[model samples]
Target: MSGRLSATVVQQCVVSLGDVRTRIDVSIKRRFLADQDRVYPGLECPVPNDDTVELLSSVIDLYGLTREVLLLEIPSYPRLEGATVPDSGGSNSGQDQDQTDGHPFAVLSEFRERMAK
Candidate 1:
């Protein structure tokens, strides 16, 4: 039997910082077993004395290759076109500011005084 498979994939483009859409197409051919050692013509049985003996099976898995292709085609880095990033000042810029709002650990000075035993 022979058949075709197709899919639409949405992926991120790292270079363009945008979404990439593509169509993937695959063709498959399948065969059935007729005999023990004659399932496939090109298949060869393993021989101990033969240096170039190759073992062949009657099944062919195409999903593994399809997944590998999808993974390889994915972008390494992807970002939005007009995304904005907030400015985080240099190391000591927010050091003197109180970040917590009325929390118990906000009073570090009192904690230090109590721990001065």
Candidate 2:
């Protein structure tokens, strides 16, 4: 079986924690083979390099296949174009101030500075 999948999803940007809209379009093809071992008595069947083949089962779950395909196509770390991740060591330049404000670890640095005094 073969089909095309297209979807749009909103993901959080790894850098800015902002909404990142992503579009995915992919072609899926799957071939199911039943009783391949029985067909060849002694010789081992060569495994295909690509993920297009599967062992035939009593039921073919199209919904599960579609969900998996969609997940594989989605970006693991979605980022907006031109957005930069703030440096971990902290920046002397005020340019990154706004960016760092929303960072989860921003408060830790502030607390450290206070304790140093």
Candidate 3:
């Protein structure tokens, strides 16, 4: 099967937690074999070296395939256009302080103090 997929999806921005709209257009080409074992006799389950090849079943799950393809195409970390997260430069704010407290050097310093005591 060969076709084109076009979709528009709204994803949350990883940094700002804002809505990020994305347009996806993908070209798909695939070949499915009737019998997988016949293709590779000795192998328990032969994985196709080429991504476009696969084993065919009685039913072709086009919906599942489309979903999987769309998911892979979608950005894992979506960022809205012109949306930026300000960096907290070691401020005494609660969240920043909590993050800094988890630093590796901070743990080492605490360990050293405990050892000294």
Best by lDDT: 2
Minimum summed lDDT over a 10-residue window in model 3 is located at 87-96
Over 26-103, each residue of candidate 3 has an lDDT whose tens digit, in order, gives 998889876856766777875659988877988999998888899999999999888877866543456646755657
Runs off by more than 4 Å, candidate 1 = 1-56, 92-117
TM-score for each predicted model, relative to the true structure: 0.32, 0.68, 0.70
Q: Clash pairs of candidate 3?
A: none
lDDT of each: 0.55, 0.86, 0.82
Best model number under TM-score? 3
TM-score of 2: 0.68
For candidate 2, lDDT tens digit of each residue in 25-45? 899999988766776777687
Candidates sorted on lDDT, descending: 2, 3, 1
Clashing pairs in 2: none
